[model samples]
Target: MNSAFLFGLLGWLDLFGIAVFATSGALAAARKGQTLVTFAFFALVTGVGGGTVRDLLIGAPVFWVQDSRVPILCLAIALIIWVTPVRIWRAGAVDWFDAMGLAAYSVFGAAKAMQLGIDPVPAAIMGIITACVGGVIRDLLAGEPSIIIRPELYVTAGALSAFSFVALMQTGMDGIVAAAIAFAAGFALRALAIVKGLALPVYRGAAEDE
Candidate 1:
C-alpha cells in the first residue's frame, strides 16, 4: 500500500485501540472505587502512553497532541464506561477489550517504525512497547501489577507479531497485509494464552530471580 493509505489505516486502527485501552482503564479505576477524575486519568494514560513513547523514540510529533481527535476519542470511551450501569461494567468484557487493544497497537507500532525507515529489530521492539506501555502506566496508576512483570505471555505475543511483520516486510510484502497478519497472530496467541494459562518461563534459581 502507499504511504498515505498506510498512515491513514494505522491512524484509524490506533484510535480504535486507544478507545479499547481507555475503556479497560476506566473499568480498572472503577474497580478501585476511584472517582470520575481518576477514571479520566487512567483512560488517558492507557490510551496515549504507548503511542507517545513510540512517537518520541521515532522523532515524530507526539500523536495525540497534534490531533485533538485522539484525546477526544479517549474521553468519549471513558465517559461511556463511567456512565454504563455498574452491572454491565462488571461483566468481564474489559479483558477482551484489552486484548484487542494490544493486538491493534502492536500492528500500528510495527508499521510506523517500518515507515520511518527503522530496522526490523527496533521496529519489533517498538511494537512491544506500543502494546504494553499503556497498560503498564494504567496498572501503576491503579496500584496493580504491570502485565509485563506477570508470567503471562503478554509482551511475548507482541514481540512475536512484530517480528513476523518485520520478516514479511523484508520479503517485500505490502505493509497493510503484513500488519493484518501480525495483528491476527498476536491476537490469537494472546487469546490462547489467556484461555490455556500459557506463560513465559521464570527462573527457578534464586540468583536468576534476583
Candidate 2:
C-alpha cells in the first residue's frame, strides 16, 4: 500500500473510531443521568484515551492534542446525546457503539504501527490496545464492571480484527480489503456475543478448599 494513502485512510478510520467511542461514552454518562459537563468529559476521554496511549507508546504525537477537530467532535457528540431523548437510544446502545469503535480502531492502530515500521506482533498488540483501552477507561469511570474482566468476547474480537489485518497486509493484500474484512469479523463476533450471550471458556482450576 502507498504510505500516504495508508496514513490518510488510517486518519479517517481514527476519526470514525473516535466518533463512535465518544458516542458510547456519552451514552454511558446519559445512562447515569450525568450533566452535560460530565457527558463531554466522558466523551473526550473515552474517544482519545486509547489513541493517546498508543501514540505515546509508539513515539508519535498525541493525536487529539494536535488535531483541533478531535476535541470539538467529541464535545459535539456529547451535546447531541445530551439533548436527545433517552428513549431514542436502543437498549445496549453503549455496547453497540463500542463494538463499532473497537473493530475500526483495531485496524487503524495495527496499520498505523506497521506504517511506522513497527514489527507485526507488536503492531497487533497495539491494535488491541487502541480498540479496548478506551472502553476500559470509560467503564471504570462510569463505575461499571470493566468488560475486559468478563468472559465476553470484547478483547478477543479486537485481537481477531488486528491480527487478521496484519496477516492480510503480510500477504500484500490491499489495505482497504484487509481493513474491511477485519472490521467485519470483529464487529460480527462482538454482536454475536451481545445477542447470544456468547463467552470465552472460563478457567476451571481445582477448588481452593480442596
Candidate lDDT values, in order: 0.84, 0.93
> What's the lDDT for residue 108 in model 1?
82
Summarize candidate 2's per-residue lDDT along 1-210 as a digit string, tens digits: 677658677788999999999999999999999999999999999999889989999999888899999999999999999999899999799999999999999999998888889999999999999999999999999999998987778999999999999999899888888899999999999999988988988766766547
Models, CA RMSD each:
1.9, 1.2
The segments of candidate 2 whose C-alpha lies over 4 angstroms from its true place after superposition are: 206-210
Relative to the true structure, candidate 2 reaches a TM of: 0.97
lDDT tens digits by residue: candidate 1, 1-210: 367647677888888889898888888888888888888888999999998999999998898999999888888777877887888754556567788899989878888887888888998899888888998998888887887887778888888787888888788887778778888998898888777879977878998668
| Residue 11 displacement (Å), model 1 | 1.7
Error of 2 at 32 (Å): 0.3
Best by TM-score: 2
Assess the local accuracy of residue 86 in candidate 1 as a C-alpha lDDT between 0 and 100.
Answer: 84
Clashing pairs in 1: none
In model 1, the worst 10-residue window by lDDT is 88-97
